[model samples]
Target chain A: MNPDLLPLALGINRVILYSGYVLLAGTFTFWSLVWPQGRKDRHLLILSIAGIALTTIATVAGPMIDIWIAGMTWAEVFSPISAAALFVRLAALAAAAFFLVDIVNYPIASWRRALPLTIVVAIAATMVASSNAVGGPWEVVKLVATMGHVIATAAWLGGLVALAAVLIPRQYLAELDKVIPRFSIIAATSVVVLLVTGTLHALAIAGGFQELVTSDYGIVFFIKVAIFGAMLLMGNHGRKYANGVALRAAAAARASKEAKINHDKLTKGGPGMHSLAVAMGAELAIAFGILLTTSLLVFVAPH
Target chain B: MSRPQYSLPNLRRFLGACVVTAFLVTAVAAYYGTPEPLPASVDTTSDAAAATGGPADQAPATVTIEPEPTAAGVELPSEGPGVSEPGLLLIAAPLPDGTWDVSEQVMLAKPTTSLTLAPADISRAGSQFGFARPEATSVQVSVGEQPVVIPEARVIEQVSADIPSTTRFEISYRLDGATVTTVPSTARRGIGAIMPVTSGLDPDLPVVVMVVGETVLSLSCPELSLSERNCGTAAGDEAMILAEPLPFGAAVVAAQIDIPRL
Candidate 1:
């Protein structure tokens, strides 16, 4: 294999693995907390399964790529650095397994679900420890900041996916009424965290404004920013639509005779629901592009 | 559902708008941020080996020095901003240890340069390899009809590598018509190759680019075990390298051929 190809392939693997873990943890958290019938929802199970499958692929492929790039035998993967990576992958696997067990044994009680969620948080923490931000000066400080960034990203993106796939399609104004507004708050906080951590990372690498444009790394970084901008626009539209739905639902709930009529109309493919769905879907697509660029950014030389 | 006096929907809209505003403002601030002034010249002649504060008693490599490549003009695609000639750009960064971390990137000149080193290079140090080449301060090259100028190139951290297992050490480039191939520096290990190239002339003027380096440390052990290994020197030590005026040469089978404008 071409030596450079190994790193690029490994970068792709990371993107896939991270997406899986984030979606799994984020979707499950929202399902358990907000949705009244979340536990019984098949969509939640499917989402968890998909996340687990992707994480598993990454866990297996990541180490192999290391071995290939190093031109070392399989036995060398037990080295300290590889071991750390393996640790994160294993935690992600365990979290996925827990989700499977929870699904297999239906009605396992609410408290028991916390096990998987706890494991999910552990996965996030381990990921942060193994990232570029950590293993450097002020390790603890950087790790904490990176961890916050990772968790917030997982929650925001995963929640959007879950909302679009499960809740938006159902279009119950009452459910939309509860989930949309609450999700908006969570997303707002997550975006703030993402923006802060992302900026810090950029400043650390670029060092100055000149480096950002002069270097190849800087050029790719700008591309990421552009994709992020698109996501923000879509997210704004989605938020507005959600807000409109909530207001209409509230007004309809207060009316005695027209309550059922208004609720049926809103629940059955209303303009607000369609708009929110499209906006959320577009935002998710743009976010995926951002993630791919991030993988490339790490591999490029940051002058 | 219970309704509060204040509208929750409005609150959601306000928060969402706030996040978007924050995102846009931060991006704008960064893109248009003031750039620092560029240094007039980088001190390329400095003997990095002596300055590294390594063990003073250690002896340097004893290799016969061949004639360096002659200074000659080569036609590049253009002299536009951010343009690089299609060839091997050998960069040597001095590490904390006396040795130098010599890396080569197969650069294809494009309208917009988005350059990245072969992952094989970053993995040289294993997982801890942050891929940060802080030592590659500048590029000194002579383009046709233009004064030799060292333009700034950015390097980002890629994936990690196992120091001992990373055997690819030499950097070589070969230009074949429209295709430019970079030989896996690892194939040569410590020994480098100097080859002559035709400088787009009728008689084919030979331009010699010499790439030679000595590995200060290499880990070789049974079964990839970290602890039980045979590394002559401490890990993370760099390979000592000397590249005379850069020139294209014969490439190895494993070398990658990158077509420009693709």
Candidate 2:
């Protein structure tokens, strides 16, 4: 491979890896937390399967590219630290797959449902810990911040996608009142986590304002932050629309004379629901923009 | 009381808007934030030559000699301390413990702000089998009367003063206790030893000089396989080697010095 192009290739690989992680983790979080009924939904199942497949490809490809960039020999490629990390990721993926099958095939208990998510979380943590550890006096703090950043990203982005899977088909339109409120709460909390951890990560990595303005890594970071801000505004708009729908649905239920009529009207997909869906679609697109910038950031060294 | 409506057009519009916004942001960032290309690596000499319809080989390597002898019994270049064309000068003075104290001086063109005297971690992949390049133990750089500080990081930044356009950078560095490797000499009946010196400045048109002791009988720069030409010149105790601009990853200047006696 051309040495100059290796970094770009690595960045593209990271995008695929990150997308898979987000989908797998987000879908699972949505099912377990916001809407358990989504577990049976075929769309959610397909998204989860897609996540697993992408992650599997990334897990294998990531190390091979790294070894090639370093120009390592065949024997050197199997160094202990790298081998151990790969083994852990593969093992966790296998266990997560088994749990996913159990969740789909059997009517398992509430406690048993958490197993797959737990395994995926372990995988995410391992990936974060291995890549994000910039050793220094603040090493522990940076590691913790990066860990929080990854989990929060999974919850927010993943949850947004999961919410789409729930909302898009209009299959669960009658249950929109129940679903939107739960997801809004999770989304809000995840946003707060993302802001805090992202700030810490930016401070640690960029070091100073001059670097942010001057360095390639810093410019990409600012672009990511801009996209993130756009995503946030869209999320807020979606929340307001969701709250309006939920409130209208509740008011209809309270009216004794025309409860069925009003509830059915709300469930049938009005202008409010349509607006919410549009906002969500926009947010997903911008989320992908953030992911692309993030992939570039991984290869572009900080000044 | 009505049926579900899925508007594909609305979804497409939102996605399109996001894409346009992202593209704009990236374009702006790229335009404003890209760094100036590294001057050392960008060789414009050949391109300029090609554009001017002149032979590229007409431009010769610039060799700089330092006045002070690095060790005892080693003579300064016979041409004296000044900028000379198409030749190199290196000096290797023998210490009490039998190791050679090798040193070289080169004049580099002034950079806009700073110059890197020695790059950190010069070891490249597949370097183990090749000749050992010289490592700079200590380096001194000056532009006219202004002494540039060589940081432990090996970069010499001229922060305090403006560098003149006609600035001549005199850089001297010791090759920490260079051990000579024995090689058979065809020119004279003596022990032939080859010493590899580091190319501190641009590898393109590098002029390296080596000064072995007065016992030196002959010198030759071996052809660097099929890629590089022999550019070694020997007169008295000094050996100068000049070659074509090296391709990426080739960084050693080896000169075989035959000494009749150690």
Candidate 3:
């Protein structure tokens, strides 16, 4: 492999891996935190499976590429660190798949729903620990900051994707009043955590503002942050539309005591819901842009 | 006017377009954002053989050096505070027992907290040891005054250390006992030392400096035979080896030094 192309290849692999993590983690966050009563939708399941496949590919391919770059033999491809990381990731994926099957088949209690979320949090920590940044100074602080960043990213971006899965298909139009508010709260909290942890990570890795602007890593980091800002704006717009739909739904419920009102027509086919869908779709698109810039950041040297 | 219906198919199409756009933008960013590829190592074995119209194993032509014998023996070239061309500086002293005491100094343009040094390949043309490969043992590395510790078995033929903040460091190792032999089909005998012209150095100028305390009977760079400047200048006691300008990978500096006795 051409050493020059290694960074590009690694970045692409990270995109696939990160996408999988966000989708899977987001779906679980939606099920557990946003809409506990909502059953597993087929589209969400498909999205989760896709995430598993992408993560598996990245987990397996990452080590192979590292070994090849080091000019090591094939037998040495699975070094101790690589092997441990791969095993933990694969085990987490398998457990997630099992939990998804159970959620889809059985009507489990709301408390048991946190299993997948816990698993994903473990996966997030594994990712941070296995990164090249582990052996550096302030190791614990960096790991905690990075893990928090990844989890918050999964909650926000992944939850947005899960929201799209349900909202676009009008799968649970009646529950929109409850679902949208809950998701808004989770996303708001996530955005706050994301900003805090992201700043800490940037300060720790990039060293200072000068390095962030001058280095390749800094440039890509800036781009990711810019895309994230765009996502936040779009998210705010979607929340407003969601609030409009929720207010109208509450009013319809109050008026329905006197006369029959078509709840589906009021919530599903309304302009408010349409605007929310468009805004969310745009947010998801921008989220992918953030993921791409993040993947590039992995290969770029910070200072 | 009716609001646009966001059917499942429509949503999928919109997302597909977004994904394509994201990929295009990311690809462009990556193309410009990533570091440039390293230069490729120049393989000069075939070219050297073809130039002389001799067998591949034929000994490379040698340049005999008769330095003005000073009373204090050969003085190694002085490396000033600032390095003009940052690369490896190798100084070898021929011991009475037919072994060379080698000390390699790494000069990098950028300051690094850690450094990894790989053993040189001794099988190349002009190396004194034809078949016997010598392992670097009792390797000691220090950045100025602080001695860096080397782990026992992380890599093969390589030693890495988390060194102090410095751009210049020295690695000294003993070549226990290498089987000394002459180049094939030639009576010339010398010590051949190959060092790397590390990346981030001026490829157009001399990147490696080899100094031998004993008198230099013959000097030649087998790898750079095809270039216009096949070899660099040999002063009183040191030889400067020129490196071919390669864009990406580190180039090899193969120097064959002939002393009075091997």
The number of the candidate with the highest TM-score is 2
Provide DockQ values for all models, in the order shown.
Answer: 0.03, 0.03, 0.03
Model 2 lDDT tens row, A1-303 = 332243455567788889998998888777777777767889999889888788878887765664444232222233233344455666566555645756665543478567766765777776764453443335676778888888878878998898787777766665777888788888888888888877777667656567556655566778888999989998888877766776677777677478777767776657877887898899899999998887666544331
Provide TM-scores for the models.
0.57, 0.58, 0.55
Q: Taking the tens digit of each residue's C-alpha lDDT, what string does model 3 give over B112-152?
A: 88677665554443322333344565667778998877655
Q: Write the per-residue lDDT of candidate 1 for residues B1-262, one digit (tens) a residue.
A: 9787467655654554465355445434433442211111111232222101112232221212123322232222232211243444343322222223343433333222122222122223222123333222232222323323323321222312222221112232221111111111111111111111111111211122212222221212111223222212211112222212222322211111011110
User: In model 1, which regions exceed 4 Å deviation?
Assistant: A1-4, A32-37, A68-70, A73-82, A99-114, A207-214, A253-262, A301-303, B1-262
Docking class of 2: incorrect
Q: B1-262 in candidate 2: lDDT tens per residue?
A: 7443545544544554465455445434433443211111111122111100111233222222123322333334545222553222345543322234554443444434544344223222112112223245456556667766655513222213334443254555554312232200011111122332323434443444443443232222232441132333333223232324232124333332222222
- Tens-place lDDT per residue, model 1, A200-291, is 66655555568666655677888988998889888888878777776777677677477777777766656767777778778888989988
Model with the higher lDDT, candidate 2 or 3: 3
| Candidate 3 lDDT over residue span A125-233, tens digit each | 6687556445345667677889889999898898889888887886566577788888888988999999988877876776667856665557678788999999989
TM-score of chain B of each: 0.22, 0.41, 0.55
Please give the lDDT score at residue A257 for candidate 1.
79
